[model samples]
Target: MIKIDAMMVCLDLSDIDEKLVAFSRTICERMQVGKVYFVHNIKLYELGDDFREMFGDVDLAQEVEGNINDIVDEQFANKTAYEVLVSEEPNTEVILADLVKRYNIKLTLLGKKMSTKSTGSLGTKLLRILPCSVLVFPETASFNIQKVLVPIDFSDTSVHALRLSKNLSDQLGLQLEIMHVYRLPSQFFPLISEEKAVRKAEEVVKGKFADLQKRHNEIAGIPYTLVRAANKSIAERISLHLEKGRHDLLVLGLKGNNPLPSLSLGSVPTEMYNTDINVPLWLVYSEEVIK
Candidate 1:
């Protein structure tokens, strides 16, 4: 049986009124995770001590309370609980950490672009610290996993992402579209026709993956897709694969020797992550696997 989970989105004050509510709705339906909580940290620092003390002039508190209810009711009418919690804490990072423990949030979806690569971005810091699976979507990301692109190099970390896909496939009732993008002709012995190299690489990928595919055939929810594209750089092939598949989520393994670092949260992932493609991305850490 697949365990149910919560989908949390950090609401941005600047954009919440326009796209935030609709974005929450998209994930809840497409991913089929019922407990969708739109979290907003309400800080009392904004309100002066005089205002805080006077229940009569507590206008800031009233406005926040109203917005929370409006967002919950308007956006998540179908969810089991459309909860909005407030606290005096200034940091969303700290607040969400507490919520993860109290509510057992399985995954958190944040609308953070990859532009801010520094360690100081709240979302970036949260990604490092959060106990749950965190999805940092591009500013223009849409919530859907219609074609979940799993970039498998067959490492343990890759398998961890695949396992998360399996669990999410069960809950969302989605097709687990698996992709393996790799290369061959390792040095020396050069008979390098790009065409011939393509055929050779195809054979290598299939030869290695035939049994792994056969073993997971019981996973009916996931519709398997094996893509073998030839490119010198792994990142280039991944970007090209995304172009062809229209994949909604890029479920990547944490570690691989393939010239690029999946867990580094750097260029390749960050490139797609920073785009306006409007697709939700799930970054699964290797050790967090529920094996």
Candidate 2:
């Protein structure tokens, strides 16, 4: 499990704010988090002279802070220790990085705008920079965790993801499923038939999974699916399986096998982050992977 001593949540005063706040509260309560930081960044362009004149003496930061406080109070009810931060820093990623370091935050919560007319560039950027794990809640996310789907590549990063998902499932009484998407090598594809290639690939994947289960005994008895990437990319296959399985959450690792020291996000994670999967996604990061 990720040691969530302190966590930060980014709010934009949209309809998803309430749901994100409620979800964070539930996580804090269940995980016994120490502190919560609710942050909202105001762009410099929004603080222009015309806006100031129109709003007449209203403190944008205070108003935003007050709004966040109301939601926190309503959802948390003074149970969890939290602070509301409103900044006009213009650079949200910078503000979030500073806050994460200053507060010793181990996890960050972000909302993915699915139905809203907004591109989630900030969330994508932070996934590359933030020195902690991130849980992105989609707009349609419910306040329940009935089932979780984890996509793995048999790397150490993916092993950590599976272990954490297993721990969470055991603690919360939720169902867990593991998915491994495999592809045949193009060079070998021309030499042999597609049917033989698929069988060979599945055999190799099954051996790796057996070894993984043996090493990580916590994931025993947990069901997993091996999918062959026929025409779609590995990320697309996982997304399709997620919808088909009706999984409530999708958990993934930030880094994959043989990742460069400077590369924080993997290719599959990048693709999934941009796609609207209509489910909450949790990107788990081990301590060694945090830059």
User: Using lDDT as the measure, which candidate wins?
Assistant: 2
lDDT of 1 by residue, 158-188 (tens): 7667877877766676666777766555463
Per-residue C-alpha lDDT of model 2 across residues 42-89, encoded as one tens digit per residue: 896756798877888777788888888899888766477888889889
Q: Candidates' lDDT values, in order?
A: 0.62, 0.86
- lDDT score for residue 96 of model 2: 92
What lDDT is obtained when candidate 2 is compared to the true structure?
A: 0.86
lDDT of 1 at 45: 65
Query: How well does candidate 2 match the true structure, expressed as C-alpha RMSD?
Result: 2.2
**Model number with the top TM-score:** 2
Worst 10 residues of 2 by lDDT: 255-264
- Badly placed stretches (over 4 Å) of model 1 are 16-18, 26-34, 42-62, 113-120, 137-139, 142-145, 163-176, 184-201, 219-233, 253-272, 285-291
Q: What TM value does model 1 have?
A: 0.70
